[model samples]
Target: MSFSLFRASVRRAATAPRAQLRSQLRIPLRKFSTPPPEAPVPTPKSNTTLYVGIGAVVAAAGVAFYSFSDSGSNAVKTGVQAAKVKANFVPTKEDYQKVYSRIAGIFDDAGDYDDGSYAPIILRLAWHSSGTYDKESKTGGSNYATMRFAPESQHGANAGLNVARDLMENIKKEFSWISYGDLWTLGGVAAVQEMNGPKIPWRPGRVDGVQTQATPDGRLPDASQGSDHLRKIFGRMGFNDQEIVALSGGHAVGRCHSNRSGFDGPWTFSPTTMTNDFFKLLFDEKWVWKKWNGPKQLEDKGTQSLMMLPTDYVLVQDKIFKKHARAYADDEALFFKDFAASCAKLFELGVPTEQWVSPEPWIMKNVDEK
Candidate 1:
């Protein structure tokens, strides 16, 4: 009986009521073989936030640098204190005229220097100084007053300019601020206008320069050469046929000294006034070769009194150049305008940008006005 009862009890224990066995094991019925879901890792979003913060810091730094640089540049530009110019520093048309009169006075007093007057050579000085510009390269212009320097002052074409410059020194003593660049150009204008030429629109922007700025002397036209040589030389300085003819009109005022350019006499009868006489004489006169021991310059066959350089003769020979010369011969006004414009440009070569006042052109008056 005991064995049977024990066996029954063991069976009852082994296969006890499921609820009772669950309670004893303390395990839930749903906990069979499924795996538990993992808790999500806490990945940070800080990488993107860090990048944005760094970018903002870099942008702020860049803005700060640009502001500093611009302010420094502005300070430099404004530092000249150009505002402090003295009351007497201001110019008047009369002042310009005085300068012109001074130049004219020198021309009148030609008996003071070499071979009588130095007016002709002074004209050459202004011509050579301005004739070296090349527009394409922007290398030359009256801006720098480079003719004050050595190689430029010593140029063969400029051989006699020193005498003229020396003569003008007296005028400089009276008006120290007017740069030599301005004086040379103004002198040319004065000589032309007083001689009955058109009123040139002159200005005073060229600053006097040191010897280092003097341009090489050969920059001017060679009186002994033909049209091809003239073109090459003037072309280097940026003159077209029209400009060349206009510039040649300067011959209307001054004479070609036998001792200077090796040609003798003035082209026009009235060598002191600006006129169409140069073209008139070129067209009206019968130009024959001068038979002197001097260079091969042309002489007026009718009078045997006036002369023309080979370069001057080419003006009539070239069809294009001849057209303007004939026009100027007929109309003094056109010659005046052209000569003034071209000559003004010539005087401004190599000028510095900063020294330029407003970059606008102004009229320069003669001495009577001063």
Candidate 2:
């Protein structure tokens, strides 16, 4: 055969075999004895997707923080000012008159308490409680209501005060919000005003006390005692001679009962009304030593109705104190104004200066009027 023809013939043989193999493989065949090796399973890709997701979250947080910082400066918060005074805690003149009106209702008729009695004793209770205040340690003031306790209630000066406290319980129920200290003091003010005394400037904030808070015994004055003893006792409470005389003006309302103070009778003719009479009687009335079986007390020589305690005699005899007493007797307005101011100061003796919201006076209303 020719060389070109032979080469072409060899190529045809090889190509012919490839085509035949392709055609034979195209026919479907089930392997009975042996299965073809399974295609190699692809290995799992490393967890790149999870890491990408975490990165996106971190980027979002970073963006948020930057946004807050880039915002305008935060507004400065205003702070409260120190040494700032709020407002006055004191009530007005109308408040006092209101309280007086209520007390009047309690005794509208002439015969109110045991045929027009008991009011004077109630006034005495208030005076004794507040009168115990000492400015030195700021203790024993109306702030504590300590009289509700034992030693204080049993005090000789405070005798028969329970009657006043018990009587006040009804008024307390009517004015539940008022503190015992406020109620008692305000009661005195109201009693005096209702009885025709000067207006007393008052403030509330006296706390009520439990039975254990009563004051020590012998804190009060004895009616039989002289000027020296009176000064010592009242002085312990931080009272001046002027304050002593002014506070004694409280006697204008109440009387000495034979059963109570052991010396019997009222200081003034008009016991219910507040007056200069206490001073007037001290100077004008001829006080004679009483001829009595009980205790040594003075009786008015003229009427024989008015009474004088040993302490009362000191007013006329003591030069320093007598000045204030005499001045009060001479001038009605001066006594009224001085008495009102001093009484207000006496009631607030132990209260801290800082705690006082207002230094001004609070005129309380009559419970009945409210």
**Top candidate when judged by TM-score against the true structure:** 2
TM-score of each: 0.68, 0.68
lDDT of 2 by residue, 1-370 (tens): 0000000000111112323532543521111121222322232133333323323332332343334422221100000000000111122234334444444455323233321544455566667777666556556777656676666777666666777787676665544334467667777676666555677787654544334345666656766777787788778877788878887766655566555556666666655456788899899889999988767778889878667777788888999889988998899888888888777776675654433323456565443224
The models' CA-based lDDT, in order, is 0.56, 0.56
Off by over 4 Å in 1: 1-107, 111-122, 136-140, 352-354, 368-370
Worst 10 residues of 1 by lDDT: 1-10
In candidate 1, position 19 carries an lDDT of: 43
Worst 10 residues of 2 by lDDT: 1-10
Cα displacement (angstroms), candidate 2, residue 158, comes to: 1.4
Error of 2 at 65 (Å): 53
Q: What is candidate 1's lDDT per residue for 1-370, written digit by digit as tens?
A: 0000000000111123434643654623221121222222233233333323323332333344334433353222222211212211343434555566556666545543322334455655566556666666665556445555567756655555666677777776665545556777777666555444556666565543334344544555667778787678767766788887887777765555444455555565544345577799899889999887987878888767667778788889999889999999998878888887877666665554434432455565543443
